[model samples]
Target chain A: MKAAVIVFPGSNCDRDLAVALEKSSGKAPIMLWHRETEVPQDLDLIAVPGGFSYGDYLRSGAMAAHSPVMREVKRMAEKGVRVLGVCNGFQILTEAGLLPGALMRNRDLKFICRDVHLKVENTDTAFTGPYTKGQVVRFPVAHHDGNFFADDELLKRIEGNGQVAFRYAAADGTVSDATNINGSRNNIAGIVNEKGTVLGMMPHPERLIEPKLGGADGKPMFDALVEALS
Target chain B: MKAKVHVTLKNGVLDPQGKAIQHALGSLGFSGVDDVRQGKYIELDLAETDAAKAREAVERMCKELLANTVIENYAISIEG
Candidate 1:
């Protein structure tokens, strides 16, 4: 599958994501700059990697979301291309209106960086299809504004529609309030858009894909991309 | 003409930065302070001389970009 990683000026995780995509898909992805308004033709997947894009100005992902590249990203999504956004990338997706809800300041007002357990809540979408539902995996989360917020009614709608892809869970894989890594509503760690073509999550799955990196639990997410597209 | 926009987190939305400021005040023996909610003040220099037009433009900027309506509210004032 052909893939590209969008690189904002301050995006530090772009290469990490590119490496993971290359390893999983057997094809190196193009590193697209944020200023470009056009995407490579017939792209199967696009990833907006994590980092303090635009230095997290005016809200975590707000400024970078307005970069010219995002307008193309949204247009590509409408055409059924799979899009993955992690951490600050997640914030960008929400701000760009590709994903619902906004990521607010973390409840404790601290930039949290740690390994956390996430329960795979949905196994039908391309992003999470390779992971077993209810399985617990470790992913590192590093961010300050990971708190996800939405009105009660909208929260219910996404939940009822099975849009939630991952929830913070204990080591045993049981989800609970105490297990919430960030102050995400309903302990949500990841969510997919209603179309199932886009996903936004706070955790960095790319960081866990190599065994030497810690664990290869994140490999399946990358693997799922190749499997679904090809 | 100049326009100033105030952007603040909506009521009931958690403001950790604001809470931190509150804590700092208490540590300084300012016990009379009950709460502290911080927001942004943005000043803009407008090319348009008409106050009404400037206000409308700034309001659009607030809704479209300046403030995230989902979690924050923005108020705009124009001065000539």
Candidate 2:
């Protein structure tokens, strides 16, 4: 798959995401700077990596969402290109109106950095096709403003449309408040847009694509994109 | 022209930081504090001179950047 990783100032995970994409697709993805207004038309995926973009000045990802490159990213997504945003990337997507809901301050007001379990809620979408529905996977979440918030009406709509892709869960795949690591509404860890072309999640999947990094649970997500897009 | 903007979390949204502050105040022996809601106060110096036009411009700024309308509400006041 022809993919590109968008790099903004303070984006620490840009290289890590590029490496993961390269390993899965067998080709190094193009690195696009945040100032660029255009992206290669042949690209199939655009990955927005994690970290405090724009120094998290006003709000996490708020400034980066308005970066020039995002206009092209939005245009590309409209033409059916897949977009995957992880961690701070997720915050940017939501701020950019590419996804629903807002990521707020953690309920406990602490920066949580640890491996947590997630339950795959959908397997039919390109982002999660390689994993079975209800499968449990472990991924590391590192963030302070990862609490997801949505009003009742919007939450019900996304839930009814199956936009939810993954939820915080236990080892046996049970989802509950106790398993919710960030106080995300409905334990949401990831969600897709209405067309399922855009995905934004708070976990750092690229951080654990290989066993040497601790686990390979995140590999299937990349592999799924390669298999489906190719 | 000077524009003062106050961005506050919308009602019905949980304010964890405000709650933390409230708790801290309670522990410090302060009483009768029903609630504590945290918000951002931003002061901007604008080149626009007319108060009406300044208010209008600052409103746009608040809508576009100063406040996220999804979870926050903003109020703008202009002073010369």
Report fnat in order of the candidates.
0.78, 0.61
For candidate 2, the per-residue lDDT at A111 reads 99
Q: Give the TM-scores of the predictions, in the order they appear.
A: 0.98, 0.98
**Candidate 1 error regions (>4 Å):** none
Candidate 1 chain B least-lDDT 10 residues: B10-19
Question: What local distance difference test score does each model get?
Answer: 0.91, 0.93
Pairs of colliding residues, candidate 2: none
DockQ-derived CAPRI band for the predicted complex in model 2? high
* Cα lDDT of model 1 by residue, A196-228, tens digit: 899999999999998899999899999989998
- Cα distance off (Å), candidate 1, residue A216: 0.5
Query: lDDT score, residue A8, model 1?
Result: 91
* Candidate 2 residue spans exceeding 4 A from truth: none
